[model samples]
Target: MNKRILTALLLAAALVVSLVGCSSQTGGSKPVEDAKTQFKSEMKFYGSTTLAPVISQLSTSFNEHYVTWDKVDSKFDKKDIAIYVSGAGSSAGVKSIIDGVSDFGMVSRKVTDEEKAKIEGYQEFKLGMDALTISVNPKNQLTKLKDSLTTEEIKKIFAGEFKTWNDVDPSLPKTEIVVVTRDIGGGAHEVFQKAIMGDTKVRADVIQAPSMGALVTKIIENENAIGYASYGMVNQNKGKLVPFKVDGIESTSENILNGTYKVSRPLIVLRKGDMLPQEKAFMDYVVSDEGMDVIEKLGFVPNK
Candidate 1:
């Protein structure tokens, strides 16, 4: 072999080896880039009006702080991903997931055995704890009832046994009792019925509102109205409605965390079968410390 030819061959071989080494290094980083791209899209969350605010805030924060790959380096762009949160009630939310209409469903109560039967291999992620508040118009003059109402008294009011405020207590004025309740399918309604009403039936003539917001509105508009709502909603409307003590226990975050609030329920997110990478990431963020901060800030008890 010629000396010049041998030297040229060695140099060419060295260049090819260097190129292969560079390719290996770049290929190793593909997974991280793929993960970023996989999640850079829209996410849909439905159900539980009580959790909608928290989901909305978390979605905003997640989009603002998280970076994604775009064929180059990581970059944070709000437009890269979008999260839409809506509340049609917990049952509807679960139905949305089973029907493939939503990526995630939010529920403020335990998943009933019947709901579980609707779909196979669904998973529940508990995000936080919430308490149902027995709310009344702030201007209500039932001072005795305002201070505290025993479980029996609450049951009586809803059962139509107590037709007037004076029937609850002699100290209270004689006025027609107005009861506001959530629609039958509402998680709040189910919880209220189980926890407070038990086997007792609510009066047939009682006014029923479709959503917590509407129930709150009805309570605020009628001085004699009493209804049950999530503590977060009642806390948000402190001046408009009074969250009365039940059986001498107030529905505060502390009480809920300590198990003293009997009306408390779990706030959960539901998904079917295995979770997509994006869904898992969002669920992880919701249980992370930063996510718990958002939960606590919205007036609910964080699971962690």
Candidate 2:
């Protein structure tokens, strides 16, 4: 062979070897990532306005950390681990999962047996703890009269048996007690009814706020209003409202975690059948220490 031609052929061989080595190193995980993406690229969650904040924040963090979701499987090139979350209500959340419309349903209360039986493969993941905090407007005079109420008294007030502040206690005032609550289908409302009202029904005339934030605002805006809301929601709005003690126990984190508080419930996620790879990755992250940090930061008690 000519000397120049031989040198050119040698250079070409070296280039081929280098290219092969590079491909082997980088392309190893490509097939795995592609397989993972086929299982799921985007995840959707709906239900529980109360749990929405936690999921929404977690989704943002998940997207940032898992540009390639190596948590559930081998890393691949950037797959859009798009996590979509919405909060309609807890009942709506359960229905969404059963109907196959949502990847997961966020529920702030326990799932009833009936709901569980409706689907073929119902699964739940408990994320954290929250309580129903009975709150009154900051300007309400009942706080001066008493900071705590017996379970019986609270029940009567919600049941419409105690129609006025004076009815609750003569020294309080003659003002008609305005009962406020989250509209039906909310986890907060269900928790409140089970813990306080029990067999008794809530007043027909009760003011129903559509969302936790709205319910908080209603309590703050109406001096005569008394309502129950998520402990985290009320805790976040501390100065804007006043939370009452139930049966003499304050709704503190320590009290809630210890089960000393009567009104608390679990924060949960629901899905049907097996989770896709992306769903598994997102859920794994959700229960991780970092995920628990998000729960704690939001004023809810982490299960850990």
Candidate 3:
């Protein structure tokens, strides 16, 4: 074969070998407690909102196999894992851990100095990057938006100062915008406040949803609803939800990686920078190429 063809064949062979090696090395859900165990002790975990999807997958995969512990009742030798993920806001998760309510807390934004001081034996680690996406329902005809609205303008719209869509843009329809927002305790709330609302509280007329799932549901149901969600949650969507450009930049991995997505935030799995062997392994798995595969599929930007 020609040199070019020969190189391509060699590369293909190498890829196949690499894939096979990974397949054989990976042990899916068999008891790992007894085999080269790295954990000093078995443990359970609960995580926060922004980290919910990734953490849940990690927890489930971890739980499938025993980790340094035998099954309590080994008659059937059922899975003896204890990791559980509770979908709460980042603030709630941090508070829970600080108050001794959970094993760990997850947050997309950096923990504040005041918050850092509150957790006694706590620490945080960044997992990846995520962007906050602005969205509107499908039926709304207003398409063009300013590259980036001022923080004041964003607050005013949510606060009901700009009551109708046309109020902000006279060329748009006069439909009353039904603003949907995250619950008060949500991490999204924190980011939105700091990035776009300054310190102002959400307007009274804004509809608050308990979770991102609910927020999406409400937005989809109400053609007039305008809301925000993590790029991961809504990027895969089609026409039911329309994500607007932020400062003329699309919230894609490309834009985020290049530092153009203004709202991109890091996703962290907190457990102190130094991890126990098991924790280290789990964290590594998450940021690893395979782990990033999951993140990408979920519509979030992977860490550069």
Candidate 4:
């Protein structure tokens, strides 16, 4: 090959490579169903840990079927170079989006007015609905908590004021009561705290579990312990757990949707400001019919 011609050809190739990199934001691209190509880029998705199961499962299936990756390393083996997922809690998810650390965030509750102001062009799209369910060990005969606990009563329980099952009500056995709760930053935790304790903080004696699994385990193992979580989480282990009544109603889907459930909250995904093209496409997929089926099957209320 002539030296001059070779030099010009190398320049052209470099230009092409540069354009591809910029287009993908990552170093690779893969085809999807319907002959579409979703750019494999370093997109981080964060939010509700409750959503981790379904989203992680579905994202895996998506990658296998329609996306490919530029696998960087373990603990990060994303097939679709465009996106990766990370989350601690729903509140954390929303915070990450607000902080611009995540392309999207998952949440189990509506964005508070204060949160809305953080991102100038914020938009919230409903993925589904979930309920804040209070759970007790199967052995605890107390079926459910009151629809709302007086702030004083809540403080009494968490503060060790009401330390026995019989203390709350004489009909129950004399069992040492323990409170297992989520970290204050969790979205559902916030709801429960607000609803039951009002402005009061969880008492110093309250046991703070690291995650829902830990909280559930604490409740199940300790017959006297009680904890709260999204209804789906509680029900999946319902064989060993008993849900409580709030007021006069049980924590069934029917009650939650019909206004009988006082703690019903929307499960959502949020994009920062107005969504980008890719983010919008992903969001639309989540709200579509097939997407909704997963939500319902997983014990959530579809936005539909």
Q: Provide the TM-score for each candidate, comma-separated.
A: 0.79, 0.82, 0.74, 0.75
Q: Write the per-residue lDDT of candidate 2 for residues 230-288, one digit (tens) a residue.
A: 78887688688888899999999999989899999999999899986567868988999
> What value does the lDDT take at residue 155 in candidate 2?
89
- Candidate 4 lDDT for residue 144: 52
Query: Model 1, 65-157: lDDT tens per residue?
Result: 764423112332334556799987888889998898888898988898888887667888888899888888878888534578888999999
Q: lDDT: which is higher, 3 or 4?
A: 4
Question: Which residue pairs in candidate 2 have backbone atoms (N, alpha carbon, C) closer than 3 angstroms, thus clashing?
Answer: none
Q: Which regions in candidate 2 have their CA more than 4 angstroms from the true location?
A: 1-39, 67-74
Model 4 Cα displacement at 141 (Å)?
A: 4.2
Q: What is the C-alpha lDDT of each candidate?
A: 0.83, 0.86, 0.70, 0.71
Q: For residues 1-304, what per-residue lDDT tens digits would candidate 3 score against the true structure?
A: 7999999999999999987777666853344466544434444344456578777776665556444233322332233455567777777776776776665677777678887788775677666788777777777766544534544556788778899988878888888889998886677877777777776777786888887778888888988888877777786565678777765677777887676777667787655334554455556666777777777777777764
Looking at model 3, which ten-residue stretch has the lowest summed lDDT? 68-77
Answer with 1 or 4, whichever has the higher TM-score. Answer: 1
Q: Mind giving the per-residue lDDT tens digits that candidate 4 earns over 1-304?
A: 9999999999999999898877665536742335234343555778777776656655665555546443333333354545577658888987898899888887877788888789778877777778877677877766553444444555567667788878887888898888888777687788777666666667677788766667788888988887776687876675777766666567778887786777677777777777644455556666778778877777677778
RMSD of 1: 10.4
